[model samples]
Target chain A: MLDAHLRLSSLAHLGLAARSIEEAGDAGIALGEVPRRVALTLRGDGEDAAFLDAVGRALGTAPPLTANTVASLEDVVILWLGPDEWLVNAPAAREDALQALRSALGDLHHAVADVTESRTVLRLSGASARDLLAQGCSLDFHPSVFQPGMCAGSHLALTHVTIHQIAEDPVYEIHVHRSFADYLWRWLEAASEPYGLAVVTG
Target chain B: MLLITCPWCGVREEHEFACGGEAHIVRPLDSHTLDDAEWADYVFMRRNPKGVQYERWVHNDGCRRWFNMARHTVSHEILAIYKVGEPKPEFEG
Candidate 1:
């Protein structure tokens, strides 16, 4: 039997120790990995009241119907991927969230899948975080446009990433495919070189 | 780069979308009854208009929804954007 505890993050081989690093009095950006987050892809008719109600009961909030928006309650966050598709995220080892959704949605012509291993989450924060992301992304990063609570799926450095802005401090949680985790990490590090990059861990 | 507006996700970079060729190309209901040339025309033929052309595009990177767009082939200006099933809007070149 494979030990779940022995599972490692995609960036594990990089040996990036999470330590606070200060540079020239202040660091421009702080990068860290939020490993092992449970992700589930949920698909259902957004216009159906019963479907929405079931999902709401399961996660404590109805999935956001607006495009590129997010809804969260406690540790469960739901991102609208499309008109009828959503991505549900919760803390690590929260497999119960999936079961709760499956049971709640019982034969309601809906689909819920556990996609935890498909992608890894990385938290990028600090004042210069948006600037660093804007270097390669085409989306306008103006505060009024891409504010907290908003999320988008766009290409960053030619890699597809789903970015969720969780704070007014410009803290962003970037979700990228596990296979591209190393490449994105190296890219972020190189990009942050201009603005002192600090790699930290929780 | 073309700034295509996704009906659901708003405006995004053109790279995030994929051009799905000319729109409103309906498949023949009586395919088996049609001859070789007629079948080939249905499969291979597309209007290569120089002026306003209706085209299909999908926001593959963002919402992943297919939408219709009317564009000027010469100027590359988008005239109108509508959802999949909606009737195409009237447009002049």
Candidate 2:
């Protein structure tokens, strides 16, 4: 039997030592990993009223229909991947939402897979967060083009990442697969080095 | 880089998509009945015109669905993109 206290982290190899630099300028950029978030890939027909109602009942909100947009109900944030597909991010400690989703969606022609263990959530926030990402990402990061609540899947540097704009200060949440976490972290650190990068871990 | 618009997802970067050769190439209904020349035409012959051409592309990184695209092979400009089973859009250019 696995020991309850023996916890393993996807980014454990990189270690949790926080690194920062003192500068006279604004908080240049802070990067950190979000721990213990339940991730699920939800697939269903968005046009079906029954399907939408069931999903809403499970997550306390309907799956967003807008392209590349996100719908949040408390701690759970549903990111629209496609017309009929969404990625649900919720608090990891709660299993009630997952159970509710399974029971409510059992009869529908839908799919719900727990992807919590497969993805690593990385948060980037600062005055230069947008500019830092703009260096590698091709998408237009201007406020007029990409605002809060919008999410997109695009290649950042050398790998694919899903970036979500969380706030006006340009706090961005990047979700990448566990295998690419280290590479992405190192790459991001180097990219933001000019702006004085800081690493924070929990 | 070309910006290919997915039928389901909106316009995304060219890297997210994978081009699947010529589009609208209907396979022979009965292959056994066809002669060698007809088989060769069906298998090898494709319209690789200089201007507007029809082709298939898949959004591999995003929605992961195959869709048809009408583009200019010379300029690499996407003229139109439509879903499967839908009629091809008229080529305006």
| Candidate achieving the largest TM-score | 1
Writing each residue's lDDT as its tens digit, candidate 1 over A84-172 gives: 99999998767799999999999898999888888899999977998999998988878989998899999999999999999988889
- Each model's lDDT comes to 0.90, 0.84
Docking class of 1: high
Q: State the TM-score for model 2.
A: 0.89
Residues A68-139 of candidate 2 have per-residue lDDT tens digits of 899997788999888888999998676567778999987898998878778888988888898899888877
C-alpha lDDT (0 to 100) for residue A134 of candidate 2: 85
Error of 1 at A33 (Å): 0.6
Give one digit per residue, the lDDT tens place, for model 2 in B38-93: 99999999888888999999887776789999998888888889898899887854
DockQ of 2: 0.57
Cα lDDT for residue A2, candidate 2: 22
